[model samples]
Target: MTAKPPISALTDHLGYWLRLVSNHVSASFARRLEAEGVAVAEWVVLRVLYDVDALAPSKLAARMGMTRGAISKLADKLVAKGLVDRADDLEDGRAHTLELTKAGRALVPRLAKLADANDRAFFAGLTAKEREGLKRLMERTAAQLGLDDIPVS
Candidate 1:
């Protein structure tokens, strides 16, 4: 008779622990954003646009590691929400650019504050040094995995 391998418990994996914390942190942030009438994905786009006056949708897609179609859908929602503006590219009539509206510019800081608070709430147990170390480890792991995508969900 062949011997059978032992099964491992879910808690035996690092990803399980990471996911447990990530899910709670992400959900809390999402709920905080809901009061401001923005989804996690929308908040990500708004935050990105906040750093620049405008960007081409294609460029934005490349930076975000998302498909142009996905970006277009998100942009459409932002436009409808009056948080973003899509304008004809001044130099290229055939192309368009995406920029945050005045409302969006004003809202970015508020949303950022919420993000900060959510992070603190979840990570408060870690000391400053421990938090820094944890961050370094996560970044290193992501680099090892060749992950450059800005996580929105």
Candidate 2:
């Protein structure tokens, strides 16, 4: 048999390294959020609603770069969880808006703390400056890729 040509190892790929770190960070944060009875996507919705107070479902769908059906599904789950309120417009019966319930508003800061802790734990090996540099690089890469949607998953 002829000798095989040399090939790069998995560790030779930048994507492999990035995926390693990303998966660990994401899974850890997800577990923390799960313990608090929230999914990562649901936490994203709650955080967004915390900023805007209320918004039309269509508007929220557009803002999140998600389909209306996806937003509706998430909203249904949140409504059932008592973390969000869905109300039809007083003037337009067909139109509805969504907002965080009082409990959701109260939970946001706690969730935020959990998020910060998770980030710190995963990045503990990096210095502050290094972390900032990494963040800037990642942000620039994402911007170059036209990736503006928040990472919900």
Which candidate wins on lDDT?
1
Q: Write the per-residue lDDT of candidate 1 for residues 1-153, one digit (tens) a residue.
A: 999999999999999999999999999999999999999989999998999889998988887888999999999999999999999998998899999999999999999999999999999999999999999999999999999988878
CA lDDT of every candidate: 0.94, 0.92
Which pairs clash in model 1?
none
Tens digits of lDDT, candidate 2, 1-153: 999999999999999999998999899999999999999989999999999998888987787788999999999999999999998888888999899999999999999999999999988899999999999999999999999887776
- How much is the lDDT of residue 103 in candidate 1? 95
Best by TM-score: 1
**Which residue ranges in model 1 land beyond 4 Å of their true spot?**
1-5
